[model samples]
Target: MVLDPSRYQDHRTWKMTPGLLRARQPYFRNNMIGLAILAGVTAGIYSYTYRFLHKDNDFADVPIPPIDEKELEQLKKEYEQHKNERQ
Candidate 1:
């Protein structure tokens, strides 16, 4: 049987129809809201993490103890003794 072009006249191309757009409007709106919330939460978490990581230390003004030569020699002797025992 031969197909007739006139019989297919009612069918249109796959362009967006008004009814389809209307049906998907709520879904699109919800997705956009969810995306906005996700973006806001991500930004907040990043900002908080950056601030936590880079904040000024409370102990920055404390002075470090000077190294003692007597303590260094004692530690070296202890380390050598320990190494010999381990071997």
Candidate 2:
């Protein structure tokens, strides 16, 4: 019998046919295709986010001043004093 040419490219139609599904049992056995598809989608989304963050310059507009060392030392001493009192 002549093979149906369309079945070669069409996944849904090809799976429905007895010959293809039965013949290729090893391809669909333990959810291999599903997991591969999920992994590919995750990788694509991660790459897209990385490119967007690196290319954007929105953070440049926000000025960040240097932290005051003296004030930070005072806060740390206060925190330690409070912990000591609690204990």
lDDT of 2 by residue, 1-87 (tens): 566546634555544566666767876755787898899999999999999989999778998887799988998999999999999
The residue-by-residue lDDT of candidate 1 on 1-87, one tens digit each, is 454334324336535566667778889988999999999999999999999989969899999888799998999999999999999
User: Can you list the residue pairs that collide in candidate 2?
Assistant: none
The segments of candidate 2 whose C-alpha lies over 4 angstroms from its true place after superposition are 1-30, 59-87
Q: Which ten residues in a row have the lowest lDDT in candidate 2?
A: 7-16
**Relative to the true structure, how large is the alpha-carbon lDDT of every model?**
0.82, 0.80
Go through the candidates in order and give the C-alpha RMSD of each one to the true structure: 10.3, 12.1
